[model samples]
Target: MARQRVPEGPTPPPAVQKLRIRYAKRGRLRFSSTRDFQRALERALRRAAVPMAFSAGFHPHPKISYANAAPTGTASEAEYVEVSVTERVDPERLRAALDEALPDGLDVLEVVEARPGALADRLQASDWVMTFRGMPVADLERAATALLEQERVEVTRMMKSGPRTFDVREAVVSLTASPAEDDTCAILRMVVRHTTPAVRPDDVLSALRAVAALAPPTPPLVTRLAQGPLQTATATVADPLAADQAGDGT
Candidate 1:
């Protein structure tokens, strides 16, 4: 009788550094749920040979923390995650490696060494761009006006408990409509405050429908442009990765 020999390799080093990453979900990958993306990221980290940290327990898991995940079925350019790694790798190099490892549409845009303070707390609001196909721009503009005039717009969402109604207007910091490709397709840009339940793009669309009877022939394509501390003076969100990028000089 003969026993098969097992090969042994050096154990992975402990994760001592935390790196924050900004990635995108585009095209078909936008349909992937949070769980689906998490699994994909884990696989990508392995494939890219990212020295990710693991928890200490019977069932050890990677020390990856996702912050402010955009809702499923929506494309985004600013999705963020903080990953603990054993070695200190250059952020740009890490970004390139992960981008190459992951699928095409699920792109890794930026990677930065995590700074002090919570990423969630720094993110006060989100800038969303909604594209409406086969919908008049004028109708969307009118809807925005109508919605702004109203003090509150309530919408019902099906929660774990049951259907819960909340005011969508109170969460809206600013909403404006403009032309996209043509008159039939309108682009709506909105900066919405992060609320308790989180008012989504659909919620704002529902409010538009209630106000000015604005409806699209097809489902609107929604993309989150950015999420960070909102500048009251200019009405824009500061780049969450700016501080890290500045320090890296890349």
Candidate 2:
């Protein structure tokens, strides 16, 4: 005899779908991938008594989606996650409940109803602010000049399956370096493609390193600047891959 599938009842009236979360990754935890955070958040939601929609299967789980996962060892003041709920709860109350269960470093800033459209749909690119120690202004300027003058910068590497090439020139919307408060350190403000072939802070660090040496190595720390649609406010966003020529290392 074959096992028969149990029929589920009619779906409940569509309670408005919502994903309530705003976060910033800080401290050593910046090294944790987005997937790890997803598990952590899922646990937190269940502990908070937040109701969630489950898929129609034996091993179903609450539907939760994260916008973008920040790179490991990189701190980000701006991060976001989307979640679904069947019951409407006061934003403040929901936030408070989650906060009590959330660990330190993972701050719950807001629980606003996500505006229409998925985050991936709304996001055009990400801004990254990176700091490197022991880099002088002159050398920094030279590297920037070399990188920008080029039409495109292609960085090659082996992926999960095989080797691949990526164009980062256009991916970098804007690249600016400034003196950090530490003086010996410099900061890079950049906008990169948020999509797959996703440019990372390490990529930028490598670019600068290729032109000039960076101090205090060992997987330099990274921090997410922002994730959203790019606009007239700065460096023009273009497909770095679509760009004509790419430069050294990456």
Candidate 3:
């Protein structure tokens, strides 16, 4: 016979304010995965005395939600999360408190009272900057040019379920290679749409290798510069926090 389920305990206090936060994962901390970040966030919340609201259940978890988390081992400047609190708190103060509570390299950059819409709906694309050390900038430029000329660039990756093949070129909104600051480095910047399986920077790199045989000696340093809705005319991504800023009259 199946075991009977236990009933939920009493509901916690209702949330009075919901805040959206923008944070950065920099340096060594970029290696931390989503699961690791979640655990750290809960610890920081408790240490900082954040008045978090809890779901009504026997095992009431904090009402925290994450969106568009960057892949592990990649740094990000525009990661976002939303949290419900039982009491009102100044966004800036909360930012400072949490920033101090968390370890170095996982910094809370900004916070705003959440606006009406879902955060995921605002994240249509991401801007990424990839630095390949010891690679020639001119080679990257040539590869980027060839990539743009192509209608589709198919690449394969192993998924949790199985291996999958997809065209990384279809999701690329913009691609460009920048002049290196130093002789030993090359940097490529790209804006890609969030597709069904989501084309990541590594996938694009795989396509480049396939088409142009451009390969870095070591793993490229990847950093997400921004993430938000794509503006097709300008080929730019609107800041996801714009609506929240307007709501706060900032």
Candidate 4:
């Protein structure tokens, strides 16, 4: 039996989207929050005239997504952001365009274009460098030793679901401290959970306060050593801890 067949039109080609982007951190601008960064980035993208994809609506804005944002006031050498555009563009040209529009301190190191539907889990980990100044060498050693001694150190986490506790040990895949060659303060290198159960410089600060007696009630200085995997980016130091991570530049 031949049923009446309805004619179907040809399938429309998938819309090509282009994302011109660069990652940035708000150092000493912690008050700005993640929303602030997004606003600034969108503004920069439009100002740079980078081709962008916009959602259809009365009021529309370019399509952009930030990978993972660093906490404010903490400088990071590495970060990630993804942008979407309607047209394909060269990475180098896109980089140059964004660079011109961005101010000093904000840099676009790479502009690689990824195809739609591609898995965004390409990034693995981020390296953070913190300075715990004024902590005596003895106290610094004790805190680090205590951290490494146990298989897991339960740390309370603040979540919308309510207060949750997680093992900082498992997340802290690597940790180390050393005397700087040119500086008087101690250098701490840490790689903690990024995707979930995110840790910050303040956590380490808390540990130092608890375990070290000679340590200061407050840190003298703090800086993000580097963020993102080592292979895709550079590191602040070339120590053994960072080498343990599969993706961290060995």
Candidate 5:
């Protein structure tokens, strides 16, 4: 067998600093797949002249880590990623540059120097809001009540291996329904704990259908409002990057 030669060169420098970014997916950008976002981000980094650290290998890649990205079709205001850079850069400046480089709907909202702990660990829960048109708030309230009354809501999702079923009721911390301003639409706000296999908004919708026979005439528009540590008492999500920002004395 013939041996392939490895490309030889001086190795890339070790990362000097790490920055965590909070970005938003809105409008049409919510439909972008994770891989699409990755490609766009890499191009934006290049255009913004970020000093990204590279992996030491024949096929070197940027040192970027994504944590618990929202499902492709759902919009999110709190998607997170961490990046390592060879040179220290001002977080605000980087945020501005990256926001300008990327398309309008994929926005960089905030950036902070990483603190001591893992970013993923801080993401303990998510707050989601789903809007349904032509659905009355009274019907939604009844369905939410039924879903909460259940001991368990088992839902199935098709995985790569096969179909798998799990109880989504335990993961739901709180669920509430309200009338939208238009009076013709209904809105549901829920706080769900991040769990194994990750219960999604769609799974909850399925559970509602199974439990209360509530079905929207049109597809519900779902958006994740926040992703961070869960406050047990209030059933709310706190800012994940607050600790890192505190470390910077900002």
Candidate 6:
């Protein structure tokens, strides 16, 4: 066998700073897959002239890390990504430039210089809101109560490998249903922990159907309201980038 010669070249510059960005997938953009967002972001970085750090390999790619992306077909207000840059950049300036470069539906809400800890470690739980049109609040409340009463609720999801069944009850930190302002629709709010197999909002809905025979007339509009460290006492999600922001003295 003939030996292949290794290509020699100068290595890419080392990353000087890391930044954490909080962005939203709203409107029609929520339906885009993770790969779609990744490509869009890379393009935006290039168009915005961001000083992104590249990997030191033959096919070098930008060093961008995504943490706990929301499922496709669902809107989210708390999507997060971290980027390494070859040159230090002002977080706000970078955010503005990228936001302008990207499409309108994908909004950049905030950015912070990363601290020492990993950003993924802080995303312990997520808060979600599901809106069911033409469904009465009373019915939703009953279903939520039934689901909460259950000791265990299992749901199945089709994975790439095969059908996987998992218990969603343990991951549910809080679940509540109330009437929307219109009174004709119902809103369900839930807090779920980031667990193995990952209990999604759809999984909770499946559990509701199994436990209380709750089925909406129309597809529910699901949106992730928050994703961060869970505040035990308040049963709410705190900002994941707060530590980084504080560290940066911003």
Models sorted by TM-score, best on top: 6, 5, 3, 1, 2, 4
Lowest summed lDDT over 10 consecutive residues: which window, candidate 5?
241-250
Q: For candidate 2, which ten residues in a row score worst on lDDT?
A: 240-249
* C-alpha lDDT of all candidate models, in order: 0.87, 0.68, 0.92, 0.60, 0.95, 0.93
Taking every candidate in turn, the Cα RMSD to the unseen true structure, in Å, is 6.0, 7.9, 2.2, 7.2, 2.2, 1.9
lDDT of 2 by residue, 1-250 (tens): 9999865665444446575477777786777677778777888888999877665555555767776677667898768777778877776777888777777777777676655444565467877887766656566666777777778677766778898777767677777778887686767678886657777777766665554454434344567766766654665443211111222112
Please count the clashing residue pairs in each candidate, in the order shown: 0, 12, 0, 9, 0, 0
Per-residue CA lDDT of model 4 for 164-207, tens digit only, reads 76656655656677777766677777766554677666665565
Candidates ranked by lDDT, best first?
5, 6, 3, 1, 2, 4
For candidate 5, what is the TM-score? 0.96
lDDT of 1: 0.87
The stretch of ten residues in a row with the least summed lDDT in candidate 1 is 4-13
Which residue ranges in model 6 land beyond 4 Å of their true spot?
A: 1-7, 248-250
Instruction: Provide the lowest-lDDT 10-residue window in model 6.
Output: 241-250
**lDDT score, candidate 3:** 0.92
Candidate 1: list runs displaced more than 4 Å.
Answer: 1-14, 181-184, 247-250
* Candidate 3 lDDT tens digits, 79-127: 9999999999999999999999998999999999987878888899999
Candidate scoring better on lDDT of 1 and 4: 1
TM-score of 4: 0.74
Score residue 191 of candidate 1 by CA lDDT.
Answer: 94
Cα lDDT over the full model 4:
0.60
lDDT of 5 by residue, 15-63 (tens): 9999999999999999998898999999999999999999987889999
